[model samples]
Target: MTISNDLFTRAQELIPGGVNSPVRAFRSVGGAPFFTKKAEGATLTTADDKELIDFVCTWGPAIHGHNHPVIRDAIAEALNNGTSFGTPNPYEVEMAELIIKMVPSVEKVRMVNSGTEATMTAIRLARGYTKRNKIIKFAGCYHGHVDSLLIAAGSGALTLGKPDSAGIPEKLAEETIVLPFNDLSKVEEAFSNFGDQIAGIILEPFPANVGLIFPTDGYLQGLRDLCTKHGSVLIFDEVMTGFRVSAGGVQEHVGITPDITTLGKIIGGGLPVGALGGKAEIMDHLAPLGPVYQAGTLSGNPLAMAAGIASLKLLLEGDAYSRLDKMGKQIASAIASTASEIGLPLQVPQVGSMFCVYFSEKRVDTLDDATATDTDRFNKYFHTCLEKGVYLPPSKYEANFISTAHEQGAIDRASEILCETLREL
Candidate 1:
């Protein structure tokens, strides 16, 4: 057996599904997951000593690419100052300031340990601020595994949401009104029915979890208007898209401002970190400022903060975002056109540095449309790409990411490998 296979065998005995995260188990793509011993630039060197071009980018955090010297040096410098303080630190304050400056909707920000904590806190703050219980989320937009958000939409907007996972109380699910993405009429109906009870509407401005789908034109502004009309907070869950899509994420790119924003991934600089920020009024509702209670012992680890600051600063340096965009377009456009030419029923939806390959004839915009894509074909393509040294996101449902590090010849090679696979398919 290979070293990675041996490690997986050992891990399965000690950990659930032999992986800490479900997707990392490679259940959807049909293979044993390779354990990476090291990463640099846009590639992962596996335990089996194989090098593969990585498009996952550590699941959206490594925007500057893995093990960049700047981030590494920052982390090293911070380590000399000691690790945890359990009290307020300068890093947290600076990180907060940087977030406010970049994300247009974030006027005040609080650091959290994980995207789940950030999202959970955002939900509670919204409810506490509005003094209402209901939260409206879209079906395919994942905002962590918070109980209220772990819901699937019912038959219609007026229907109560159903639990998408086990162990979640049915009553808690009802507090969330899950609706189909890209449909504003359903949102209007929900608000019309529960206008008085809705605390806020939270959605991924770009639904990255379900194949990186973009909002239909005017869909975001429509939601913003409804929230304004109903006095409900509008929350943008930009955990996946935040720093990866652009400095201000979808809000800046599309010119729509939300009342609250949850962020993670790139902001953490490949470390465990998350944050929530919004209008000062709504944010003031938390803890020492107001009634909503949220606390994290390691909210802003000094090491993570220093590394994150370096990552964000790197984005502003020269042409990182532009280069990433160029890489995204180079690979996405090439593969998509090839799929079309070969008569493969495929759709590759991409934006900025994020993209996805959906084996579907129809364009994917809704949860139903995304689910209907042919996973079998995608699984074959995924394994083939892996064999040829390109590592994409393991599932058809997850979006792939590129990094500034990909600008140096990686983009062209990835495009060639992907097109070759499409032709083979």
Candidate 2:
């Protein structure tokens, strides 16, 4: 009597792969995905009426936990005012002001419907401002589904890019240069060959797409310096790390500010929202101020703005981030210790409330390193934890998130289950 299985059967008839998002299909972990009926605090009640301690946190937006009273109340209140006015709203202005005040790099911000919209718009603005067609991005850093950025490496180190997806023209991909993560030398080489034509370099400061990989010492600072030296904008795609890593995002943590920043996830307060912000000079290249054009009918939806304000206001109060760091360290240390005791090859990388467990003997510093992890072992562990009432991210490539609502007791229970699972493995 698995409700999730029944629903999944029905979903397959209505949606592609029985899921809207590919990751949600549980293809990586090899199982039918859990259909959650409700979520509160730090737990999710699946359609089968099973309660599990949630670690994904809705892919890093549930910092205050799912259905937080403040955010829910705000959404309910906004519903009374109606949805989608298709015009300027005061809530949008308030959300923008909060972002500018909190993020050191964002002087002004424009709202879009999703992270993809934000990254796409930021790249277009960069090209328009610098009058350059080429852009540089690191491998495994997913900015969105932009065609120009959808490129894989060619045969050699210095070779140009090839289309990772069909329909992306080779000419469009040529404008994008792909490089290895944390390799400053490759970045230099790309700039050496096409620096003048390179409009900007975009990347995730703390990449979470392929597990949690932090930038090497001075890696981010080097990018900032290089972009400044080359007169090209540096765009930090903080869509995943935005408020999850720290209140000011990873830019604040690293002390290296980018010329432009793209944000999503927590900023939307669990709704569909994305933003691109930066120095006035670059942002002015968008819309009425410059030739670059970007528009969205539901860009700054009032409901999303209200929820965002509520969430940020809560984060701004007192020591939320400190608590999050404490919790993150506790979980990482516990899992690491357990893996060691059970003779499991585990590499746990953590920052603030985000963490990832890579089942590999080698340290995971890049996508290539992360890919080397034993997925078969992880798949076994994933199901084991799921049976023990602990919910983790389905893919090894995705990071686990903790919320302010996750208590010490929940962590202890999850850690004990993980330890037992490792021993069994």
Best by TM-score: 1
RMSD of each: 3.2, 3.3
lDDT tens per residue, model 2, 1-425: 47789999999999998987667888778878989989999999998899999999988889999999999999999989999899999999999999999898999899999988999999999999999999999887877778876664211111111227678888888888888899998999888888899999999898887788988898898999899999999999999899877788999988889999999889888999999999998898888788999999999999999998999999999989999899889888988998888787899999999998889998877767876789899899999999999998888777899998888899888878877888888
User: What is candidate 2's CA lDDT for residue 420?
Assistant: 81
Judge candidate 2 at residue 159 and give its lDDT. 14
Which residue ranges in model 1 land beyond 4 Å of their true spot? 153-163
For residues 4-32, what per-residue lDDT tens digits would candidate 1 score against the true structure?
99999999999988987777888777779
User: Candidate 2: where is the Cα deviation over 4 Å?
Assistant: 152-163
Cα error, candidate 2, residue 363 (Å) = 1.4
lDDT of 1: 0.87
After TM-score superposition, the amount by which residue 338's alpha carbon in candidate 2 deviates from its true location, in angstroms, is 1.7
